[model samples]
Target: MIPSYLKDIGKEIHSNKESTKLKIICTCGCDEFKLFRKKKSREYIKLEKEYEEQFIKEFGRGFEMQSDLNGQVFVIKRNIFGKIVKKTEIKKLDIPLFKNFISVKCSSCCREYILFDENIHGYDAVIEKNQESTIVESKHYSDDSQKIEVIVYYNDDNEEENINDLSVAFGRIKIIKITNNKKITYCDFECE
Candidate 1:
């Protein structure tokens, strides 16, 4: 859980109108889950609730949550861009359906979006458990100022180890961005 002090700061940030926007992940690919292993409506609903609670505890309140568009658009209050950047990096992540357009939305008036899920989760899990990693550019933003960066986290400690089963454990990330014009842009990592 985020510390209380940080939540207070997040509240203050959300109150500001001129805050920059950030989208951690966004997807544009096909995976096995989309073609097979379909989940029931109730299962999707439960997943949405679980993700919402986790998002709220990790992020904060005043954010929007929904399960429309295949669990897309988990909107959060604006002004949490910095926090998103710092926390978006997965330590031991796992998910099985992130490569199927499950985007997250940010209601900062600027409309930020992110694509994250099983693929990303699997990537992080593999990297944490194995040793090989791959970084690739997945998608770029329509905005000239923003670019989408997708990194595949993996680890192949044993050359004979097969990652086929890990499709449900680790994968890729699609980042949607909304740049802050006022902030000085530095490296590729600098979003604003």
Candidate 2:
């Protein structure tokens, strides 16, 4: 979930003419929406640092925790006290990476739309703009050379005046790369 203040800003953006062209219409036929950039708060960043410090203090320098895009955190533990450090255990932690998303809320029915999320390793995003449209593309690549792309199309003038607005509206955007064998594509559009 994003901060309420950001949602308030979204409501303000929703009132803009350019925003009307960029909003995703709700199933209820409402085109007005509150847009929010999902980002990590300062407190969250500080806590994350503290957690990393504590994790290193408890498990030593070589041990580390891994987090997936779905917000699952896990650590591998070995039986260090035993004579043989062969047995290992996998433990899940409650910490979640809640950042890196774009959320939109319908002004009428209050429905929420979460976009551009992936649960794979090596995730990236790219934003491309021509005179007529802006395309936000997200890519996920696997070690096996498989890549999946999700592209969101925004039809607008892409002018300087609306650049800041669009940046704030879309939050953190990312990019993609083509792999050896397989490619998959998915698209979503928001236009007047």
Candidate 3:
């Protein structure tokens, strides 16, 4: 469960507003935390980076918890909110890092989350993967229908590739390699 102050932070993220304080409440009753983000005018980049590192260190590296484009992010966890709220003040609650950091629930919330199921290593691979994204054809809207926008991941190298050919046809394509146990994970899309 998100506290009032923290919920405001979420709202701020959605609105892209500048906020100074953030309050977060874990529904699991494990720990309630409050975060005070510096003003955008100040040097927030460093603070945000620190937050990411600390978050990963506390939560572990097993799952990706970042928020996605649509902001549909969540991780299931058992909560005992009854005991936690009883001991704290509802209006003025202050605590440190959330209890037992789980996984990220949003990307905008964190920005370091890996939302894709596969690990993309190049642009060609990204084009191939994003090709599967549902295509919304614009009818009677405009004639610029030859172009398509796709979301994908690529490595530091070979990040630029052509997107035109990938969406031209839809079959099955592997965009990149996924890593497991420090090894690459390969994916094959099979069309029925």
Q: Write the per-residue lDDT of candidate 1 for residues 1-192, one digit (tens) a residue.
A: 111212211212111122222312223321101101113357766886787789778767654434455644444344545332222322333433322323222222233332333323343444455332223234322323333223222233323445444422322222333344333321121110
User: Roughly what TM-score does model 2 have, to 2 decimal places?
Assistant: 0.27
Model 2: per-residue Cα lDDT over 107-168, one tens digit each:
66766655333221111211322222212253222223222222222334434333423432
Name the runs in model 2 displaced over 4 angstroms: 1-23, 47-98, 118-192
Using all chains and alpha carbons, the TM-scores for the candidates as numbered come to 0.22, 0.27, 0.18
lDDT of 3 by residue, 4-36 (tens): 213322221121121121122233322212111
Model 3 residue pairs with clashes:
1-27, 6-23, 28-79, 65-104, 66-106, 66-107, 67-106, 67-107, 125-175, 178-185
Kindly report which residue pairs in candidate 2 clash with one another. 124-175, 125-174, 125-175, 126-174, 126-175
Mark the 10 consecutive residues where model 1 has the least summed lDDT.
29-38
CA lDDT of every candidate: 0.33, 0.40, 0.27
Pick by lDDT: which candidate is best? Answer: 2
Task: List where candidate 3 sits over 4 angstroms from the true fold.
Answer: 1-45, 64-71, 76-121, 124-163, 166-192
The model with the greatest TM-score is 2
Q: Global CA lDDT of candidate 3, please? A: 0.27
lDDT of 3 at 172: 30
Model 3 lowest lDDT segment of ten:
142-151
Between prediction 1 and prediction 2, the one with superior lDDT is 2
